[model samples]
Target chain A: MTVLEFDRITKIYNVRGAGQMKALDEVSFTLESGRTLGLVGQSGSGKSTIAKILTQLETPTTGRVLLDGEPIPRHGKALRSYRQQLRMVFQDPFASLNPYHSIRYHIERPLQLDRVVPADQVDAEVRRLLERVRLDADSVIDRRPHELSGGQRQRVAIARALASRPKLLVADEPVSMLDVSIRLGVLNLLADLQREEGLGVLYITHDLATARHFSDEIMVLNQGRVVERGPADEVILNPQDPYTRELRAASPDPEKHFATAARDQGGAR
Target chain B: MSDALLTVRDFSVVYDVDPPVAAVKDVTLELRRGEILGLAGESGCGKTTLAYGVQRLLKAPAVITSGSVVFHDASGADIDVNSLDAEQMRRFRWDKVSMVFQGAMNALNPVAPIGRQLEDVFEVHRPAMSRAKRRAEVAELLEIVKVGAARARSFPHELSGGMRQRVMIAMALALRPQLMVMDEPTTALDVLVQREILRQISQLRHEFGFSVIFITHDLPLLLEISDRIAIMREGEIVELDTAERIWTDPQDGYTKTLLSSFPRLTGERGVVVR
Candidate 1:
């Protein structure tokens, strides 16, 4: 089943002195249940714009978004209900989390706001959620955001997002701010969560290598348009678009391919 | 590459809080002329702290507890950066050694025009030069970084992220410093833009004959560009070797684990047993 469908979405911003900017242009894609769609793009490629639209933070200029085959209402009671089914984990964990609040408060507020559990049961649910994200409940519950490391703070953000028990998740460059050594661990956690919860995820990133490893389907966006879309492996290995090929070639390789290429040229000389 | 252009010996940085915390401990490394030295570590591993220590940019809360950073100047004078006063250090900062910071978007002033920012650097450092000569030099600097001269008139907000990064590089390269310290310069950019920026930095180093201290967490990127790689763990340098040796035979367990954590595109998934 299609958990989320975006049909012909476009976003235009009008500048007062400058002309209008077309941020997103007629983008269309479908995210299936229990699968991940990796949206790959550069800084201005409308990847973040799509994530905001999916999370209902911003309305598209022209298009419709459907959740489980029903159109999401623009405002009022129905929109609030639709929002309860989707949640977003922002790119910057340091900025997304409140500095003054404890981890327990951050996690429990979402549960209480959504009315996911009773006041007495909210503490237990928060602890369970913390454990689900591999954070120790006793050690981490009372600590503030400043006390935790970047990775730990991100895991708390993830737990807070999962507190709603939403069917769909939109993670916008979740690990880009993290260190390289811990990035894979977080990616692994996200993949495991998707598998266990059977949640549809829109994984947005500019890193093709990680997207290829993590996502079932990949969509390459360039200048507000879908340049290529297919199975993640197929699109990465056999990229049809020149833009996609350039992006792939630019990515750093762990196997020292460039050094070998330089060595081969030297040997030939 | 010859004997170290910059030698950091037994360097340690401590934060003077209510209780002191050592950010960098007994770290030692060398950067040769016209060679790139890559510093790799996780967050809070003191990579940035080490960079700040070298330039004496660390403020009051952070104190240099011990050791010295010696820079071999163009006239063959060995200057200890730690001993320099604020006025002397200001003169040495951009004229002899420069820095290109991460998040070029935030580094540039939003209200100021790009040309004016570049002119400010020239005005402070090279006040003897004529205004027209300064403009020509600014245009040349922009051209060297592949940014058009027309962009000098535009504000920081008018340019894209990649373009702003190029402007940052141009500003750093304006005075033709002997050494450049880049702290995660391309982390905020995309893959293609990152590659382009790295290639430009490599070319600039070749043209100008300045050494580089490149700090980043991306091992693959460091392997691609650096001549020597130094792995930092907690508060110390764990391993310092050539890029080839560091990749194949890392000495420390933490270094090995960091190398193994990178997800491979064309190999067995998670086969890198730490």
Candidate 2:
């Protein structure tokens, strides 16, 4: 069953001088539990607009967003409860986490607000969340965000996101800020958690490579429009759209291109 | 590429905290006259400190305890960067070597036009040049980086991120320094823009025979652009070899882990086994 459905959602931002900027032009897609939907797009492609609409951070210019066959409420307690089931992981883990608070505080705040578990069980649940994200609760629980590495901080961010027991996660450019060496670890952790928890994930990113590996299905966004949509492998490996082809060509693969360049130069010498 | 442009020996930088932390330790490397030397490491691995130390750009508390940075000019003069006085270092900084810092695209002054910023580089170094001559040079530099003459009048926020980064590159190449030290130059840009910038850098390097000390955590990008790669772990250089050797047969365990951490598109997806 589809957990969240963005039904013909369109977002328009009316600027003073710029006039109306159509951020999302009638974008529509549905995400199911135990499945991942990758929204692949570059900057200003309305990827974040969709994420904002899903979390009800912004009201759609037109159309509707349905959750479990019911249209999402605009205000009041319905919106509050709807947000509990939907959590977002941002691009900058450093900024997302409060530097003043401990890792436990960040994770427990969500659990306390949502009342996901009993008062006494909150600590144990936090520990479980930490372990699930491959972080040692015993070592990192008491430490603030400043003390942790970039990778560790991201893991903590993930743990905090999972504290509310979100059914649908909207992670927008989550790993783009991370270093190359540790990006896979976080991606692998996300993929693993999605499978284990049977949660629907809206993985929004500009990168085609990680999206192909993590997402079950893919949607390519360009200038606030869905240019292409299909299974992840089909969209990535055998892309039909010209924009998708350009994205594929832009991806840096040193082994295929750089390694051979070195070989050719070495042979000539 | 036969002659060494810059040679660093036994360089170490220590931050004077309570216990004193050594950020860089006994790092020795050489950059040929026109070769690109890639420095690959994690965030706190001291790549930036090493680059700063080589040019005597380190400030107080972050002391370069012991090091020797020798720059060999085209006329074959061995100039010790460490021995240069404050005034001499000021003159030597951009004339001999220039740096494109991390997030340098945003480092452009928001209020001033990009043309004036490009002109400032030449104004400081070549004070004798006529205003008309400097204007012509500034326009030429902007065009060289592919920003075009029209972008000169535009503000920093008006241009795109890639164009701003191109302006930074144009300014860095303003003086035509022998060595260019870039720290994660294209990290902020998107994939397509990043590809174009890398291509532009490669093209610029061929056009202008300047040695580059390129530092980035992305090993594959380094392998693609750099002639040689240096892998730093903790505060030390664990391995330094040709790009081909480093890619094919990494000697150090840390190097192997660093390379394996990056996921690839061609290979088995998510196969970067910990």
Candidate 3:
């Protein structure tokens, strides 16, 4: 079993005119192969920073990320292996995918790069990966990203991430770009894959409802600080920090009937 | 006299391609006086197409096939929108109806200061207004959306995503138009900011009494703010009713599926998706 530990990571970005900005501050958390951790925050709350740190897109200012109690390799074959173990599913599938390439080429690139299967079996594995994501392999494999719907394109992206057979998946707002009707579908597909494959997932999003529902644990971030972290229900239903509470109040609760329709609409918020 | 602020009959938008795909097929709708009407649908379901068609904002390749849009002015003047010429259409747009689209960067000019851009709205629409009055109005519009007046000096790039969206909203509100058609205005914003913006929109409607066509794929948000909701699917409006009814007892099977798409904060999760 794989255990990833993020130890006291701090990332400070040197903004063009603003000099320096702390994107993350002394943030630390543990992710295990069999569980999911929801990283919840607003746009500039440093949620993406954590994802960047994990994927090695940005180096930490003062801390380290350890996989199985060892520091991650910086470069060469070890770095490639580290990447194979940790994969990312970006938010915008439309932009993430290339318009020119067919879906087969997109998924095949990852499989070939990782050598997930031999030459002759590559075609079969591509079909299998597409099927695993619950997409109709025959219908979509030959089509370009533009030909597919937002949901279908996202499913293909998930299939591509799973192509590496990673131990961990860093999904940064995976469904936020898709239409609301199709968001839950992509999310459920991710959750099902996590359950079936025992892949540790860092589900990063500004949405609390989905986080509480899908994650085993929820970590709240505010302006680069980890304000609260606990069991998903505890963190969401009974938030300790004011930031989390504010976030909860802001999110439109589908079950909470708005008394605005009844009254003068003063407290619709 | 009808209580309807706007009436649309037999509206359809067809793209001129080989087979000629109908993006919006005969969508008949109405906006009640001073009510927030929610247009909910997935992407490519023709929600945007209907909004664009209503405002006559749609350009070539996509043509309005069979439709009539009539705007019922509060002064008892009924203006048939489709017959207006270019100059008349321009004057009618911001003066009678304003639209906030996705509420993002492309909505504003990156080169000019926000203050100048807001002033330009008055210059172009209300040509005779004094410079000082335009500046004061810009500040007031900025205040209404809760953005600091200091942001007026900054360009679009200098402002945060949420701030830029609020500025777009400020621009939309400048004309005091009878109808505001906002297409996914808060979709890109964070949840906290989104709620705040919605609250502002709701409050502003109460204050100004301008009717709104709030379009988004987010159904729950529609339930929160909209008095009535319209559900569109495959270029046609399948269901249109009070928001409460849409939420509690969705009649159409497609509406039921759309309602069940979101993961609820309470109760059993994913009634359909799971």
Candidate 4:
């Protein structure tokens, strides 16, 4: 079983005039295969910083991340090999996808680079990946990113991420840009794929409700510090941290909001 | 005064593209005074098109094909919105109806102090007001939105995202318009900030007694604050009702689908919302 451990990752940024700014403070967590960990916080909470550090975009000021108990390689083939095992899914599908590249090309490059399949089987692998994401491979293969809707584009992104056959997937705000109606379908597909592949998934989003719904565990970050972490239901239903409670309270849950509103109106009358 | 502050009758808008497409089709709705009317739909559903058509804000290829939008002026006049000329429309716009667009915070001038930008509203519309009076009006407006009178001197970039959004709301309320059209006003903000903005809007509406047209794809958000909601699908309004009714007993299949789209905080992991 594959295990990804993020141990005490702290990131400090040197601002122009602001001196040292702590973007992340001693944040630590772990994810095992077949489990989903939801990282949630407001903007500037350093949730994205964790994703960046994991992807090697930014090095931690202190602490380190280990995959299978091995430090991530700094450069060359080892770094490339390390990257091959962990892939990223960005937030905006429209921007993340290349406008000039065909959907087939987007899915094929990762497979070709990672050499997941033989050169002859690359086309078939692309088809399989597209089909896995529930897209019609025959129809969407030649189309550009703009040709597909936002939901379809995001699905293509997921397929591309899976093309590498990574053990851990870091999805940063996957469906935040999508229309609310189609977000469920995409999320359900991701959940299904996660279970089927036994992939350790890091679902990062600011949306508390969805985090609670999809994640096995929820971690709350506040201004670059881990404020709360626990089982999803426990954290959401009876949050220990005041920040988590405020987030839960602020989230627009119709059932809770309406029920409370009705009681308050009744009491007022 | 009539309860209906604004009535849109048989309104339609079409994009003058190759083989022309009808973006909004025969949409009829009324905004009651002091009520928050929500227009909800997915992208390309024509809710935005209908709103733009009502305000004659569509430019170029987008044209209003048919119907009239009438405003029930508090001065006991039924003003035909489409008939107003350029100057009259300008006067009619900020003076009677204002808009807070999606990502409107970015619309502020970066070089100018936010206070100066707010004062420009009075400078242009209330042309006879002195400069000092305009500044004070802007300070008062800023305070009303809780951006603080001191923030007037600060540039747009100086304020946080939520504060910048509040500044936009202050600008919209500068003229004290009777109707405010907010198209996805708080969609860009975080959950906590979004709730704060919504609460501020609700409170302001209570004090000012002005109607609001809030548009977004988020049905749960509308269900939280909107008094009445119009569910649009494929350029047509399929359902219109109170938020409580829409939440409890949605009539249209599309509306039901939209409501169920949100993943609930408590329920089966893969399926169903609360």
Which docking category, incorrect, acceptable, medium or high, applies to candidate 3? medium
Task: Please report the TM-score between candidate 1 and the true structure.
Answer: 0.94
> Which of the two, 2 or 4, has more DockQ?
4
lDDT of 1 by residue, A190-250 (tens): 8889888988889999888788888889999999999999998889888999998888888
Each model's interface RMSD (Å)?
Answer: 3.6, 2.8, 2.5, 3.1
Q: Write the per-residue lDDT of candidate 4 for residues A1-269, one digit (tens) a residue.
A: 98988899889999998899999999899988888999999988998889999999899999989989999889999999889989998999999999999999999999999899999999999999999999999999999999999999999999999999999999999999998888988888889899899988999998888888888999999999889999988999999999999998888888887778779888621
Q: Assess each prediction's global lDDT (C-alpha) against the native.
A: 0.88, 0.88, 0.90, 0.91
Fnat for model 2?
Answer: 0.54
As for lDDT, the candidate ahead, 1 or 4, is 4
Clashing residue pairs in all predictions, respectively, total 0, 0, 0, 0
Clashing pairs in 2: none
Arranged by DockQ with the best first, the candidates are 4, 3, 2, 1
Residue pairs whose backbone atoms clash in candidate 3: none
Top-lDDT structure, candidate number: 4
CAPRI band for model 4 = medium
Candidate of highest TM-score: 4
Candidate 2 off by > 4 Å: A259-269, B270-274
**How does the DockQ of candidate 2 come out?**
0.54
Candidates' DockQ values?
0.49, 0.54, 0.58, 0.59
Give me the displacement of residue A12 in model 2, in angstroms: 1.8
| lDDT score, candidate 3, position A3 | 97
Find the candidate with the highest DockQ and give its number.
4
Worst 10 residues of 4 chain B by lDDT: B265-274
Clashing residue pairs, backbone N/CA/C < 3 A, model 1: none
